[model samples]
Target: MSHDILRRHLRDLIDAYNFAQWLKTLKGLIPNEFICKRWTSEPNGFIITPIDQIPGLNT
Candidate 1:
């Protein structure tokens, strides 16, 4: 329902699907600075950080 909730759900799905690795792969293929900038900017806007950077994920 709400936009914020929907975004969170989507983000959770992405995380569940291991989308960060996909993003990194896509970024590598594209070789665009703007894409890299956009990817890095997302966490500041959404409270979502990379799963790999999370403490529990590394364990």
Candidate 2:
């Protein structure tokens, strides 16, 4: 999705995906796992972990 489209639809998308709370909870997580395993092949970088893995995700 385009940045503009993503920006405009963020709220709707979050609600539709049932990820609003997940996103909020993940905000504090540490980067332990890769968001995508293949992401490691990229020159840039990527990271992922369970939302509950975050320091305060359960709060």
Candidate 3:
């Protein structure tokens, strides 16, 4: 595979694993949820909102 294709596959695998972990261990809250909650409490710590880190609207 080309570099871009390989990178995409790797990212997909990571996302799938993360989703499973959230379902199995994290109680349906994503790893990003921690960041998002912190972002809510402390906006100065982040340059961008972690809401974008969430999986929604396919973005």
Leading candidate by lDDT: 3
Q: Write the per-residue lDDT of candidate 3 for residues 16-58, one digit (tens) a residue.
A: 9978977777566656876677688899999877787577795
- TM value for model 3: 0.43
Compute each candidate's TM-score over C-alphas: 0.31, 0.20, 0.43
- Top of the candidates by TM-score: 3
lDDT-based ranking? 3, 1, 2
> Quick one: RMSD of model 2?
12.6
lDDT of 2 by residue, 1-59 (tens): 78988887986886767665555555634234444333446636535434344465365
Tens-place lDDT per residue, model 1, 9-34, is 99999896776676577764533444
| Alpha-carbon runs more than 4 Å astray in model 3 | 26-59
lDDT measured at residue 19 in model 3 versus the true structure, 0 to 100: 81
Clashes of 3: 0
Clash count per candidate: 0, 1, 0
Ranking by TM-score: 3, 1, 2
Candidate 1 vs 3: which has more TM-score: 3
